[model samples]
Target: MADRDTVHYDGPAGGWGSLRGITRIFGKELPAPGVLDTLAHQNKPGGFMCTSCAWTKPAHHNPLEFCENGAKATLWELTTRRCTPDFFAGHTLCELKGWSDHDLEQQGRLTHPLRYDRETDRYLPCSWEEAFAAIGDNLKRLDPQSAVFYTSGRASLETAYLYQLFARLYGTNNLPDSSNMCHETTSISLKKVIGASVGTSVFEDFSACDAIFFFGQNTGSNSPRFLHPLQEAVKRGCRIVAFNPVVEKGLVAMINPQSPTEMLTGHETPISSHYLQVKAGGDIAAIMGLCKHVLDREDEARARGESVLDHDFIARHTHDFEAFTDKIRATSWEEIEDNSGLTRDALREAGEVYVEAERVIGIYGMGLTQQVHGFDNVAMLVNLLLMKGNIGRDGTGISPVRGHSNVQGQRTVGISEKPELVPMDKLARLFGFSPPMEKGLNTVETCEGVLAGTVKAFIGLGGNFLRAIPEQEAVAEAWQRLELTVQIATKLNRSHLVPGRAAYLLPCLGRSEEDRQAGGPQTVTMEDTFSCIHGSVGRRKPASEHLLSEPAIVAGIAKAVLAPNPKLRWDDWVGDYGKVRDLIEATYPQEFRGFNERLFTPGGFYRGNSARERIWKTASGKAEFTVPKELSATGFEDRPGRYRLITLRSNDQFNTTIYGYSDRLRGIEGTRDVLLINPDDMARAGLAEGQVVALASDADDGRERRVGGLKVLPFDLPDGCLGGYYPELNPLIPLSHHDVQSKTPAAKAVPVRILTGAAASG
Candidate 1:
């Protein structure tokens, strides 16, 4: 078959109107009667801001910054499909479960508010007040910890802030958010090395960098808008070094559908100067190899009496480098060479790029963060950057390309389980309520806590929390124990499966839709990947008029649970979101400076963080570094029937939403069950490509998940590791297997084996 690594696409690359033409042809497109004009792209002369990927290329920061995925997000958000109650009345919950993701969303927009009817197995129309009262009653019945306050990346800062506060007022600190699942390890490790979990560089820095190192991130499909800046870097002679098992089109060179120059010439931008296909879960080894190469180059340079690194930056800004150097020197070159899955030649070339270039920026994504040794993998990258004095400088820093618009911003605004002394101490001082000092549950911890029946409720700001987790069956069962589960969502997906004793589906306005309350139309705030927070106002009507804004719902529940809350003013802010903004400004002063007035500005001002630039807010006010003896190698168990399986989202999907029908890069369409495996391993097991296989997870109890009837595509994966799409294969992952420090499911480190068997069901 055509060389296995080759990417093929039959779909027409019809720039902008591809979706519009399809909408006219097909009946299933928008949630309302017609498509709304709600893309985050600022095409209008001076219209509203984009609510898609946080990256803003407005003429101010403009270098033409829309990624492919960002375009898809904009297109999807501004759809014309509607799922009226009449549509649901015509179908059953059972039918909807069997429907494809595109089919479910394509049915139309949710025209009216819907509530799950247990007796009838159908979603019936329910008023916003009725849904709110039902949710309030459920919150009144349980302890706060049982209910998890989950947030999706698809929310505004205003909604996310209000949701987190309401959960705190209800006495629960189980804020298991989207960040806990993807880049918490990046935040954790970056905090130690650079004093911040966020990538230290801004988009403008890419323009000035001489070299860019991409580790484990497939940006083209995952975050397409980044291509413009990357293309510019290439045009200016900045070499791009990409390291990952899969060679993505976006990372390589796919003609930018939006670029007039590339489109006119029908030519693609050359994405990478050197593409290193490292084995899966070999990031630490790869990073350590790069470091060793740099040291070797330094040694050679010392012969000529010239230093290969920035000694002054290291001497003044860092601590314990002598010990770090000792460890680096003692590390065996053999381990680095073998474990990294890259040749010395490749690493040497990478090191040359670092040494030759005066300034370098390392841009990475979740592939670097979701490993068994995720934290250490991140630390190793930090160590590489530190060796060259990359932080706190112009045109050189670590830029972690975050997923979901503003996912990182949500964590900054108090969605984290790891409480800093500043926010925790301030919360007790300002609100006059004793905050829970015990470290609460994270993503996997929340799930395990629920399985043990400690957590009683779950309130999601947005996203498919159930489908997003690993081991779908066990997570689904754990969710069944909750006293109440509420999803404040724009569209429904797999999360509703966790039917609590009382489940409330509150329909809310999306970023593309307008949010109106008693205080007139209100705009919400969101932060981009660069940690820039700004406001978002929907240009279209609500998907359903019966829907309420997330803030109003949060306030409603706060009023219900904190009936006797003396200091907490819930209704006051509900009447006017500006009051909510005022409270946010008063509480977290780092952001929201003159909250309302700032929105009137063009794209809003960047809330500068000194801490983000290596200014540690830790106890000693210096970043701390710790290495888990058992990291990245955590899932490298030599079990007989087990292999490390990393769960990933496909280019066709965003977070847990299946936006498109296929992953064209992987040669699969109309299916998510295809597993990426090494050809040698498949042959060793006597398995052929396109084989239907049964996977029995060795979770002590021998949990057998029959996800059979699947194709086995041989890929450039490490011999002992396999890769698959998440949420669907989540059932194979045990809820107990998680990172000790982060409480995140080792989604990048799950171990499972394949067998020929029957189709698996959830």
Candidate 2:
């Protein structure tokens, strides 16, 4: 690991750095010819989706719609490297667990179905029929509640819909997915206040908005494609404001790699007009401060016989406006400034810019959703937008930038643990079976169940559950107690190493690979961040002949588990995905009314958010304004030697899938074990640059959660805070440290302490 060399990159995002990233991936993963042709088809009509972020594409296609990370994801899938049974035979399960996450994936794509053999301590090849049969037999012997079906965001609408249907028919609502960990707060908070779970804004709103307020979203790394519209918006005089703990390079400025003028002239487009360095987990307080500034100015404007708040819009379309404003008035400037890490004057200046704009859009990411007060954070943001009549307008609304390509779509198709969120009546009528009405376990709850030895089986649709979750060591240990484990994936990951007694690794087709069934070559659909449903048809051949389509694999397992029923034709549905769409339309008629027709049309179609139409599904039948009871966004109190740890993804990573060790954006290369801290905090704690320190959780759970040998690197961050890569720092975040309502792990705000000397070894 090269820890001593720190290169401060000054160039804007998406310049030579992005180009080098693409070339490096191509050299390592896609050495085959015709790769460029396949990449050109990405995010275009009659082509596959980017298969990365949920960020949607425009109606008019750009020659290169994909970004560096997007290209890495695409080429990573199309790699010729194969992980055959022979490769598994060379290493034992116990030995593979010691490898780094990047090295494990670099072993290549899984080309065959594998079954773990305890006798040899290695994975052996197995037929699909044998694997499905064994899984069915194990599931039959256990209670439905003991089995957890976890889906990643990579699964398509057809696959997710079928997966949910299979789980419901199996008599359990234990369908925990990747959404539970990342954006569950968005669904929970937005649904309660705005009557819809998804964002109300469309992609085109970026062009029409007068101002865009960014809250805790790192656009350069997580969703680089978004930088284009933001750059265009800046050129057209749209005021962009950002509130985040780290001063992200992407938000500062960007150079479009595709723009020849920028590349030739080295011109960097400034993104955020104002960047506020708010404390980690202090979003609620900061937003409240903005609200207070606006309300105070509203009072001055009223005295001068001029209005700031939209009284007509609030009275006609919203409820509880007075109570919400009263709470804002009660909050003192001292409390706001202390908690938010921003001065009152700074907030007022940003608020003034916001008030000057005729229309605005609020865009956020996991930063606002992965905290203890994540639900309140989202609610307060909505309150600010509702105060200005930002919702349900042409150039205004909220946009929760999702990480996975199909995570939102999975929730839309009933992959939720909460039964009430789905239309149980419609499902029962269509499927001819009584669906489980009880609430099931979420990601955190599922971890608890596994640790307690209650969850007997785990079936993953795509993601690496063990690597992506919190309490890594504890969860991995508990996973060994499972009776059966099944992973349907295209490539090898860490989750496959910690297999259950009767574990099976089933290789599936990638999004870039064609899926040919009995009916014909079929295309799957995914709902983007903006709620637009688009079709994705793969153009490349399968990586291996043995690889099965996700829908086919799901149906195969479902048929083997359930008794032959006349109502559900598992074979026919898998044979023809159109039948799956027919059922999906029948289940959610309002959202997918003309599913097939609209899916094939140009640019697809929007599912339409009721909140966007001012049709509040809340009990009050109007948009709501919620008041904060406290100023602190994180519930934890300040203490000596305690620092709030913020978990982040590097530029070379997407979720738990790490592409490389180098974080080009932050200028950290060849190591993910470094901790970023402020220079003042480092001096106060008696720590030196490149010092290896241990981070131990400060939770009162009586458990010792520590990560050792993290080199300390001085950074520009808020006081009393540290930034570290996720999964490596995930152990420091307890499962109990989550939003009470949304149950999303507070990965963004973990309380911890640094230890030196002999303690660093543990």
Candidate 3:
């Protein structure tokens, strides 16, 4: 049975029309008529960044600032509901555990401060003054080093800038953010290959590309508003090659989300003339295949006395071409075909398209980052771009579609665990005192630290770290060890469930809600994927009058913790956060020039990272070649009945929250219980559509872990594989299991075994 609170519909999950099911982003029960005002702030006036995905959109004076998903994000944030401490009184930790994500949040916006009363098994309300004081008192209980501060992409640039400062000022460098969970690899790779970890292209880049390779991302669900650009690009004859295990309709739809003619008449813009389905972990091999095909064509051209390769660009702009070429030549055709889930014809077609295109763009999401060889997967694409001289030019570069709205922006304004993190270290030296020197934990490390008892306290600036993390049991164990858990968020989430022996749930303002103090109105900044820095403010009155903005919340905590009087007057910052901007200016030089003055300017500013020009800043000062791997994710190669299960968030989802039960594109609806399976695999297992089966972990060394049970159905999926919604399947993913180089959990690839009813009937 579905959790009692889940909204029920009578359709297949993915078949719902994009326009018909967008309301699922908010609780299906919430009321709304049409689009809401998106121009909530003036810090940038018409220069509003897309509030949805990291993908940029043209600044519009249009009233609908919110996309379908963006509306969900807004409505969910601005709901009239409130989940106060008294509400917690009715629900115990045990009771809440059985509640679905929607039910937990639908309980209402939390108004008063909340503290988990273990004796009562409920989180009773605590006052803000008491909550702040109690949190400080709890911090006084542990060594500052033992406390870990976690941040989410939901935080504003100002809040994050102040957050790192407070952690250092209070004496600890433990800052692990949502970045660790998603794109830690992109940050590590970009910072190493390029001088900075930001993208080179702007929104105009999409317009410039003759060929765009979209890997591991579904634009329709993730960036619905930005789909118009691709629609235009396709109309301009741009060739789009989509490489994902499950072919998303967004990549092939002949309709555009923004076009009224298309919307009124259901016309989708055609895309992905070539759809190559690569095995979950076979991205590197597929890239190698492309390289082989392109290089071989170059050889054929040379024999015919014709030019095929861009020899001049490769010689002057890049290095180690010979070694890279040798590796591609040495790779065997059979190996390539078997490793990648692609055929020679498909690979050849893709290579031909790339070779013909003048400007090429490679766009990827968690698909490229959430693998054991995820880093190698990206480097191959970068190598391909470099081979064709497709970088540093308009519309020609690698763009990693970020998960959260300002995930990359948070890093731009300085929230990082990078050991030699330049932003924080520079601020530390400029201000005073030594910043924490030890390499901080990424999301994976944070989980281990929690379980091992090395970490005792957790302070979150939005984001549900606990529920969002892989391995439910491991996360559950580490969470219980926290001496104090402080979550600064707008609504209830699973991270709040990780009650510290003493926990504090401090409600904060949402991006859609107005935030004002004695200083009139204030706006915070965010960084888009294009390295553009801009500002935003709230319009709808906050869900609750008691809510505090993230900056004010952080400032209040600092006041309570930095006792007796610290150098920075926390009170003054609370009084006027412009002073917070002053501190951010001092903390970050260069880009934020005349921080206060420039901010008042119409278009805020971009903290320029020019290496986005392909000026590799690595120790070698050249783009490094990451060696591809041969090992598939575990439990697959050596055992029968074991299969690879990749977890995904459906259309009505963003990270941890599930907005709707239906997935409009995949043709699923009214239920999230069905697992997507290849017809071949379904036949092999004798599983028919809607037959209930269990998804068990291959992680059982002594004890088995069951992620969830779902009805199997034949869907558009690759052979030898199955798929389902995530966090629900996250339990099967162990914390110990992650991409070694980047601490990102392999959410896209997990080794699992399918079982029939009653454990093993087959």
Candidate 4:
């Protein structure tokens, strides 16, 4: 193992440091001609939407609206280097499997369709027709229920719609997506409370909000574009509160690159007027505490002949208020303080901020979603917002910050394992086929099916499925059992390296590359976190002429796999993507009406939200409040040497893709094999700074899951809570330890035992 470098990163979130990182990637990758121009086009009208975070673009465009990571995503896709046939011929699959994920992708983009040759242990070039035929044959051999179709968030709305449509038409509803792993809890909880599965507020609400509550989301590294709005909100005296285990630099202070004065003078805009370091798996308790204080204040106000609770709105548009308050009042402050790892004064302060604000926006991410009680965490936040009648109001609503650019859009276009969510009747009417009604597999269920030898074939649109899934070794073993695996991607990842009995890599056009079909240059649409649907058209030439658009690839497979159906025009749809949009509009008339024409409009259009209109689509015809059964914090009380582990992404990385080994914002450099633990926990565990340790799962499932050679770094974290970089620490998470409702892996809160000295070196 190599020695890791650790340094203190004292600079503000986005300054010269961020600019340097963006230029460094571009300098090394050396993208194609006119590739740099794509930056100017990003987030602008009639230009390509960023493939980075799902932060909504402002109604008015700026000259340089793109952020640092956005630039990295564009340049990463537009790299000049190509993985041609010659490159594959020189390196066998076994040889390539030894390379690090970063090094493998750094070799450059895949330029052709390649099939794995088991005899030679090599991936050789193959024609697109042959590849598609092989996939068709595999599908025909297996039962429709035995195949899982996975969609990545990077896929365009058209591609995802067609992908799910093909799966359902072929008599299967097994449409799993990236959402199953990340924000499924948000969808499940919000749908139960607000009758909708998405955020209720739009980008414009940011300016009107009096207070913004950020939970478990690192706006700086994960979604830097959000910092701009937050900066403006702070300037206008808007109170910003952050709740997380780690105090992120972006949430602490941010330096806007677009502001010349701040950039020149090193003046940083402070974010998060109040920062609360909630322990892992303690969000539910913390939120309940806030609600408890709010309800108490409301009672006091009522006694004084003043109304603090939105009585008029609650009486008109809500349900189960008394039951919800009963639960909140029953929660003791002792439990809240013990579980939340904070004082009652802190909870009271947060509640005071919430009470004083006229309008508030609650924003959260995976930090609250990747836990056993993830749904409850989200529901508690909703419960607090409901007390003030925050929903269906300007600048006051719930916002679940999505990680992917089009993740929400993919769900909107029917990329779900649940068949009921898909409009089968609409599809049958439009395309004249009996769509599958049987429920399919989610990400977790798909992995279980693979392990059980039930799911024989897997087709991935664009993602590192094996690495992103929990129980890395078990997932790898399941992959080896599959009959066939197909990867449609732009660059090489670990999933491509682990071939099944037969695997094929089909390279596709990236987001930054032009997708010119028979109809000429085309544009694709994406729905941001705010439900704003907009068009994204690429100006840069394709990295390789051989690369096909994702939609085209899905169409080819569909044409080959499904039996002849007169209503389905796979070829025609591939020739012109607008036809796909037209069909989408026809299928989802309520949301996508005039979708094609709206793409030409400035800033695109908003997908009208029913919850925002106060039209409750719930069982009671009103917004319902849910009460959590238990508000206790999670801890390893039975196990002596155990701590709660929270997996995190590095500043330079997105999800499982590592841009670099260093997490510059956290003062780490040159390596990712370090763990961030509370200094007090380190002392209790008899560990010192820079001491190497091995983390073993305390899941007690009789499976030995451990990651060795992790250096310990003491930092300011809640006691008994440890933090480590993801994909590396993913092995510690068990597939069985997931949320009961959402089925999302509990990556945020894993019980683990730290081993030092000889055990660590092993």
Candidate 5:
């Protein structure tokens, strides 16, 4: 193995660095023709949505509206390379299993449907009809409740709607999705506090806000396009405050690639005016500290015959204020300072900035949601927003920067495991079938069921489910117990390598590929993070003639599985995607009126939010003020030689997909095996920089979960906290370690001990 090089990057984000990334991906992946056409059409009006981040686009987009990662995602899908039957014929499943994730995907896109051959220990080409027939037969042999249908955020709105419809009509609601792993905490908490599971503000809100606070989100790398609005906000003298464990380069400064002067001068626009390096999993305490400061200021103002709190708004639009205030008053400042890893003066200063601003917007990411207290963390954010009447108004609200391109849309179009959230009666009236009323399995529940031998069949719409889930070895074992497993994907992933008794790999058309049916070329719709419904039309030809559209593949499976149902018009829906949109409009007329026509409009239409209109549909008929309890650090605090571990994505990766081994932002090159630790922690642990070590989880579950050969490097993180790349460290996170309410894996906060020298070698 080659040793990785570590260097500290001192320049601002974006500018030439981002441009170089775009050029490198295109040069490596698209050596063929149609490169310019593909680049021009990305994120344009009536063009395909970039299958990267869920950031909303402007009303009128430039020809080159995509960011660096967006270009990489597009190139990854439209690469000239192909993984044909001949390639699979030469490589056995056992051989492929040894290949790294980057190598497996570098083999290129899957060109045809494949089935595992047990005798040969390889995957061979198979007809789509034959594969679907066998899968349908297996599914028929098992109970509907025994089969779990999984959906990825990459699935378009139309595809997701049809997927849920099929799963519900099949007599089961066993639907789990990618959202369950990432933003389910935001959804669950927001629904309870604000009567909506989504962000209340639109993209335009960035322009009107006087202050913007970002927690646990790296705006420059994860969602590069968002920097445009943020940079603009900074230019207009807007205050930006960030609370994170690491001082991310993106939060420090950003250079707009679209600005000629910035590119020429190498000048950067400052992002965060204040940066607070809070401890990992200490967001709740930090937020509470800020709230306490605000309350103290309010008391002082009252004594001076002035006002700091929005008493009128709070009295008119919220509830539970007394309990909420009492809890904040009870929280001691010393405890807050210890737990948050920040000084009381710093928290007071942040509160002063927040108070001075007329309007503020709070944005967060997985750092706030992927923990044991994720729900409480999110609720605390809402509490701060509600105290100042930041929600349900222009220029102010809470925003969760979603990672997936259409994750919000997928949930909006009925991808939830909860049947009550989806209108079953309306769906039954439209489809002529009684949908199951009982709640079904989520991602975590599905895994448990599979391990218990209850779930026999699994179908993935679009994701590397096995690699994304926690407890890698155990999840792999549970997958093997399944009678049938099917994956609809654009390329090969680790999930396809781990097979069940009968496994099928079905290749589908990517977001950049044309989907031609009996009704000629069809356009799919997507919902962005801001709840804007827009159309995405791919102009490029399909990578392979054998590859099918997601809708076509889902429709085929539905046709085969629910055979002989006269009322179901799967063939008709497959012929024209408009029929799918028609049914969606019929099902959700209020939210999707004139769905087809509105999709053709410039920038599409907004899915109006009741919360934004100050019309709370919550059970209390008003916005809620939730009282957050005290938060405890991970149990490792008392355990000597143990540290809190946080799993993170490298700059070259999107979720589990690795584009390269290097993370340019953090200055690590040619490898992803380095662990970031605080200098103080390194001294206390008797470890030096660049030392190779082994990391072992302190789960106390009697299983030795460990990862070896990690190079340690001192970082600017808090003492007793360590950081490592995801999927590699996913094994250290137990499947049972998740939020109590959201069931999201606590990948952000894990307890582990580092072993060096002879201990590591053993």
Candidate 6:
């Protein structure tokens, strides 16, 4: 770990501290002079969406709708710094690899197209025509299955639609994206249980709900804008219950920066009424305990000829109710307490709160999804909601908080690895070509394919793929063997340095920059977490004159690689983005009906969820409940010195993008390599605060997975649990350690051994 210091913060989330944060960023990043004027338009009518989290905006927008993190994202995008060909010529690939992720991002936006010069170990400026020609040449030589088309959350819906179209026309379904990493479990699990792949609740539900139950979400760091709603709900007497390993400050209390009263008085509204520090990977067990409590109440109610359960609603709108209750009845309190790390009394109290509320909204984040039983965990939460008839009504439903800005929109436009998820038949009819029908590779499979020398090329629309992926050591080695690598991004990142034999770096316009075409300025749409699609138009000028809009870039690549079709003209789509939206409407008529017209509506349109209407598209035509065979959430046996490793993002970080070294909320500054463990676990491992240590995975794989020189920072985490930053701890996660169903990496629950003494010196 780098030189670091620790301090305690007693203030709530988003207070004067947030104001100071923005001020510090202005000095550090030195953004364009009129950046503040551009930020004012964020999430407003005829303005761009905040490029941070995928949280939805309120119907009546706030003046300063953007949060501190969102503002940071805007400033980060509009920074005055620029990375030109001169910067690339000055540093070799080997030398650039030595710089940290934060330092690389600080180098600013890329200004031109570049190609790797193997002889000089540097990247040289190249024309877009030459770059596209070279990529087309390399791709045609390889089997279509050997290539993987990857997209990040930054890609707009229009861009994503064209991207998937280009890939399918290229004769492959190998389109894997950022969703494969985070919310794949939510997508697959929700579809099975409720016949919907998205959260049923909307932003309005927060204000109308009687209670909100949070599972494994850190609202302060993930999406600070969400804190305002929680604050309002708390003030209005809505109950908030949280279950998480770390004592997330956001859930405990919040001082809304948008509220003039709170800002003037420095008053903090307590968010969560009851906070349960569930152990890492203990969400499933804890949820089971709550279900058992509800079941007990149902039994009592039945004896008295009354019912706490929604028997009428359950009978009419659900299936597998008896089977679900039977399993909950069979579960003993001892097993629940042992695995959940919560006592019977505590669960009963929480259950009482759930039972007392007329309407409750169930909310969760990656804490429940990035696990061995991620699907099971999410399904179990839905089961709890079904018992209380919380499925089809205002202020009641399941909400899986999505992390990326357009991750949901990308999936909406068919950027999935699953063949059955997208309407391939509809696409085939529209394009007059046979689209690929076979299943494609997800994130983990893509990595495995690369390691096996089967996947030869990777084309990334956006994202630092090498850093975002797990098994960093292995993937980094396998990445070098690829025949071609192409990255289209706004800034310089570590992934750009890991070029293949034939690599190209293409610069693209950011979300806040203007995109001009033949028709005029264009707007792209993004789907928020609640299935709401809205338009986003850039306010400022482009970062570089050479940069192209994502849609234009996709069209250019498609033109160069595929055979010209008389029916489809790539040039038409590039000149006017409305043409792209029109095609999207043609493909998915129900969802995108009146696509262009509805996109300009004040708050945009809702892509309706059938589950919310009590219309289950499942086999049984009703909501179903699922039960897990195993009680252990991590699926790992108890072993001494082995702890469940939970990877986390710092307050200064967003996904794989490192804004700075300090984590303000956690009180750790100047380093990102510190481990947070419980005081008891630290002593149990014969460790002390500030001790240099190492972590090694308990995976049975023959390969050693270890990262040393991590400074131990005692925290309020549950015993037998450890917390560390992602990418730094990704090396400790084995490739096979993922959900078998969704193939999402089990970053939340990796069995690892804390190494000290001799091992620490490695």
Q: Write the per-residue lDDT of candidate 6 for residues 1-762, one digit (tens) a residue.
A: 111232346778998888888778778889977788888888887889988899875568888988888888998999999999999889999999999999999999999999999999999999999998999999889899999999999899999999999999998889999988888999889999899999999888988999999998899999898998888898898999999988788898888887789899998999998898887888888999989988888789899998899888899999998888888888899998888888989888898889888899999999988898899889999999999999889999999999989999999999988889899998988889998889999999999999999999999999999998889888888898999999999999989999999999999999998888888998999999988898998978888899999888888888888998976768888888999999899988999999999876766689899999999988799999888776666867878778899999988888888888768787888998888887667777778898898889898777888898899997777878889999789989888888768988999989998888987677
Task: Kindly give the stretch of ten consecutive residues in candidate 4 with the minimal lDDT sum.
Answer: 1-10
For model 1, the local distance difference test gives: 0.68
lDDT of each: 0.68, 0.89, 0.72, 0.87, 0.86, 0.88
- State in Å the error of residue 228, model 5: 0.5
- Displacement of the residue 319 alpha carbon in candidate 5, Å: 1.0
**Candidate 6, pairs of clashing residues:** none
- What TM-score would candidate 3 get against the native? 0.93
Better of 2 and 5 by lDDT: 2
TM-score of each: 0.91, 0.98, 0.93, 0.98, 0.98, 0.98
Candidate 6's C-alpha runs over 4 A off are 1-7
Q: Write candidate 3's Cα lDDT for 1-762 as tens digits.
A: 112222222222122355566544444535332224543332235333444566543454234434567666666665666787667777788878888886787766778778788898888877788888888888887898788888988787778888887887777767888888888877766665555676666677887889998888877678765566777799999999988887676776645444577667655556788888887777877888888889988888899998667778777666778888888888887888887777988899999998888899988888888876666767787878878777678879888888787888777665776646646566666556666666666778778888789889899998878788887787687688788899898778877876889888898877756678777777766777776666665666666677888888898887788755445666677667678778777766677767666543443455766655566677777665444555242223635777777787777777787776767666666777667777777878888777888887786455567744587767666666678887788887877667767777877878788888788333
lDDT by residue (tens digit), candidate 4, 1-762: 001322346777999889988988889888888876888888888788898888766678657988888888888888898888888788887888788778888988999999998888778999999999998988888899999999888999999999999998888989888899999998898888889999898988988999999899988889999888889999999999899988788898888888899889999988888899988888888998888888889889989999778999889999998999888888889989888888889989998999999999999999888888888888888888888988888988999999999999999989998877878899999988788888899999998988888999999999999989998888887788789999999988888888889899999998888889998899999999989898989888887878899989999999889889888999889888899999899889989999888985675688888999999888999998887866642423435787899899888888777777768788878888888887667778888888888999998788989999898887667888888988889989988888768998888889898988787777
If ranked by lDDT, best first, what sequence of candidates would result?
2, 6, 4, 5, 3, 1
lDDT of 1 at 501: 67
Model 5, which residues run further than 4 Å from truth? 1-7, 633-638
Q: Is candidate 3 or candidate 4 better by TM-score?
A: 4
Candidate 1 lDDT over 451-541, as tens digits, reads 7888888888887788778667776776766777787766667676447766777767666666677778777766777766666666676
**Collision count for each candidate, in order:** 39, 0, 25, 0, 0, 0
Candidate 4 deviant stretches above 4 angstroms = 1-8, 633-638
Per-residue lDDT of 166 in model 4: 92
In candidate 5, list every pair of residues with a backbone clash. none
As a whole number from 0 to 100, the lDDT of residue 173 in candidate 4 is 86
